[model samples]
Target: MVNCVVKNWQGEAVGETTLDLPVAKEENAAHIVHRALVRQLANARQGTASTKTRAEVRGGGRKPWRQKGTGRARAGSIRSPLWRGGGVIFGPKPRDYSQKMNRKERRLALRTAFNSRIEDLVVVQDFAAELTSPKTKDLVTALARWDVTLEKRVLLITHEPHETLYLSGRNIANLTMILATNLNIHDLLTVSKIVATDAAIAKIQEVYCD
Candidate 1:
């Protein structure tokens, strides 16, 4: 459980909010969170990198020189790994990099990781209504009011997608916006600061606190 001060668009503390998601035990918290983080990153890889081996390289069937009596090192196939334009030796091949974890354990890890970042979390009122237009300047000012700076990587979690809010924040290079329902371990842990709307917090609790 955590207690957070809720601020308005002007950065005034108008109220407070609490987060009470179930998390892993302290003894296993770090391990579970590490596993979850690794799984998320690994699953994101495309695993499309591939290379040809000596046996797979074209024109490797013919030997370039005899096994002995050559002035230079006795060369075999022109596609030898030691030569240029040759097949790779023990190179990577395309394959799946995804990792799997139990659903309950993954959720527990997420809860633990999120709870660990309480100190860096900032809760704010739903300010989508405050933005009359898709102005990045307005969003920047509001973020400044919330003590977020352009130098830091920020994660903005909202209850749902708001067109105006999205437009306002899309241009901020360091800002990442995501829905509470789609929360994942990577964004939650990588950001320097987390700015979540009060409604988003409620949504997180509803979706994750089982």
Candidate 2:
């Protein structure tokens, strides 16, 4: 168990909480975290890219010229890949980019990500909308009070989705807010620090520690 100072919306140290690191035989926490992050990022992609092939191109019905007799090269349709403004020869087509890892591997990856963040973890006593609106400015100010700068990518994990908290950090480029239920490997590795609410920590323990 590790004791960490818990801060409030004002960025003041309001209390402290104990967090337990999951015990596992895996020693390469960094590698696990990286794998988890890769998997999550892969899943996020829509993989909707598509391209038209030469056969799909329009205006290729007629041959440009006779197959023979003419001095010109034997020609196919004007929309052939050899012609200008033709369809792609071997372009990418719409497909899924989602990669699947086994449940055990996914869990391991998440555990590794959590371990990586442990070094830079910051706990918040609670997320009270009354104290701060879901504005980037408010989040920035609070982080500043805690001496956490915008230079480092920050992940704000909570037990549940807090509209104010999510809205506040939505505009921030490097700051990401997510609920514990949605926690994935990709977001965990991308962020430099983890700022978790007390409830979130408990939830993580409940899900991963057991």
Candidate 3:
């Protein structure tokens, strides 16, 4: 078990919480989570874009000219790749980007990500820092008080999207916000550190626990 210090709104350490490392240390947690999130992100890709191939393009079925009659070079179809406005060759086609992963695998991946956060000993704090208005300066100032600067990418996880917080952090190049329920492996792997709300941590435990 490892102790995670929790802080209050004023950036003060209010208490400490213990987390079981075993749950986070499953054999392939990282791999599973990475796979799951990769699948999810892949699915989110816009694969609907499609282009016409020579065979699929209109006005391409007939030979452009007689094979031996004209002085012009032989041409198979008007839509040939060599012709202007011709169909594309080996172009992109519409497809479903979604891939499936087992429910257990998804859960494990999520647990692994959470465990990674714990291992990193990311900071968890109360939600009292919610801003009434969107102001990047205020949010930066708040984090500065905790000795967290804008130099590194920070992931701010909350129970839900707080407009004020969202707006405040939107202007800062190094800060990003994400909802707890939508947590993903990339965010965990890429961010310099995580700043999660207490409620978000509880929700994570509830969702990942076996």
Candidate 4:
């Protein structure tokens, strides 16, 4: 077990909590993390690119020239690939780029990503933040106090969604909010720093530490 500092919403370090290294100590953590991230990014693609094929391209009703004769390669139709306004050949078509990994692989990948950021992890002592109203400045100030900068891209993981917390961080350019249930390797690898509330940390341990 490795302990990381535990802080409050005000950014003051109150104590420390031990991290379950068994999960973090998984074999080949780095490789698995990379694979998972690649899969996640690939899966996010829209695959909307499309092009007209010979059969779909409008025209081609009649042959431009007879098979034997006026030569010029014996034109078949204006819509033929040989023509200027013809359909594309070997063009990219819409497709699913998503890659799938077994349940064990996915779990290991997530663990690896969390392991990679173990050193940069900050556990908020408060189980949940209490905010009466949406206030971006207050959240921004607290993060600044903790030295979690916007440039590094702070990712806040919570055990459950909080309306106040969500509203406050919505407009922040470099801050993002996600629940522990939806946690994935891609977001983990992209952020420079991670802040998890006490509940979230416990959830991570419960879900990933075998």
Candidate 5:
């Protein structure tokens, strides 16, 4: 097991803890990580974009001009693709972009993500970082102490919802709060650093560790 420090809200290391080797460590799989990332991005698409086909466009019922004999080229409906306000020939329609990965693959991808960010992962003991009020500046100070710039994206994970923490992160555009239960490979790879509390780490191991 790899040992990592548990830091206080002031960013001082108060103690150390061991990462559950099987859950937090893994053999790197770049391809699998890419695939999982793609799947996640694709799934996030609303896929609600739609366009009118020639058949669906109104005012297309009447033929615009005679089929032949006129100096002008033979014409069909004004809604033809060649004309202005014409319907799209082929366009996006409502669809489901969601993709699925097997359970084993998902677990592997998450573990790989954890391993990739091992150096950037920090575990904070619950009491050391507990917040009773929602203060964005306080959160910023805490992060600055850890060398995690507020300009860069940071993922803050907790075992359970903490009202102050959630609200504090709301004002910080670059900071995001997520529950350990909702943790996925996408956020892990998207952020520059991860700050997870001891409770959150325990929760993640409980859920992901075999």
Candidate 6:
């Protein structure tokens, strides 16, 4: 359990909130978080890279020359690995890079990772109602008020999708907006600062706290 100060749109501390999520034990926390990160990165790979082997190369059936050639080295096929324009040797092929971890472990890793970043977390009131229109400048101003540095990577978590909020934040290169329910290891760990709304914090606890 952690106590967090809740700030309004103007960055004033109006109240406090608590976050209580089950995190891994200290000894195994780092290990589990690392596994989760690796799994996510691996699973995102397209695994479309492919290379043909010597046996699969075209026009490999016909021998370039006899096994006992005259005045030249013996050749088996034009597509031989030793020959030019030939198939590759020990080349990579398409494969699944995904890794598997139990659902409980994955969630534990996520909670641990999120919990580890407590110092960088910023709890804010639901500010979607503050945005009357989709204006990037106004959003920027509000983020500045919230002490969010415009140059740093910022992850904004909200309870649900707000059209104006999304549109306002979409243009900011340093800002990434996501729903609390959609939180994942990658986004939860990559950002320098996490700015989450009051409702978002509640949603995260409801969905991930077990």
* Predictions: Cα RMSD each: 1.5, 2.7, 2.7, 2.2, 2.2, 1.1
RMSD of 5: 2.2
Best by TM-score: 6
Q: What lDDT score belongs to each candidate, Candidate 1 first?
A: 0.92, 0.77, 0.75, 0.81, 0.81, 0.92
What TM-score would candidate 1 get against the native?
0.94
Report the poorest 10 consecutive residues by lDDT, candidate 5: 19-28
| Each prediction's TM-score versus the true structure | 0.94, 0.83, 0.82, 0.89, 0.91, 0.96
Residue 92 miss distance in model 5 (angstroms): 1.6
Worst 10 residues of 6 by lDDT: 62-71
Error of 2 at 49 (Å): 1.9
Model 6 per-residue lDDT tens digits across residues 1-210: 999999999989999999999999999999999999999999999999999988888887887777773778988788988888899999989999999999999999989999999999999999988999999999899888988897889999999999999999999999999999898999988899999998999999999976
Q: What tens-digit string does per-residue lDDT give for candidate 4 at 73-140?
A: 77777887767889889888999999998777888778767877887887886534457788998888
Error of 4 at 194 (Å): 0.9
Where is model 4 poorest over a 10-residue stretch in terms of lDDT? 21-30
Q: For model 2, how does the per-residue alpha-carbon lDDT over 170-192 read when each residue is reduced to its tens digit?
A: 88987888887778767776777
The true-versus-predicted C-alpha distance at residue 70 of model 1, in Å, is 4.8
Superior by TM-score: candidate 2 or candidate 4: 4
Model 4: CA > 4 A from native: 24-27, 66-73
**For each predicted model, how many residue pairs clash, with residues at least 3 apart or on different chains?**
0, 4, 1, 0, 0, 0
Q: Ranking by TM-score, best first?
A: 6, 1, 5, 4, 2, 3
Where is model 2 more than 4 Å wrong at Cα? 8-15, 23-31, 129-138
Better of 1 and 3 by lDDT: 1
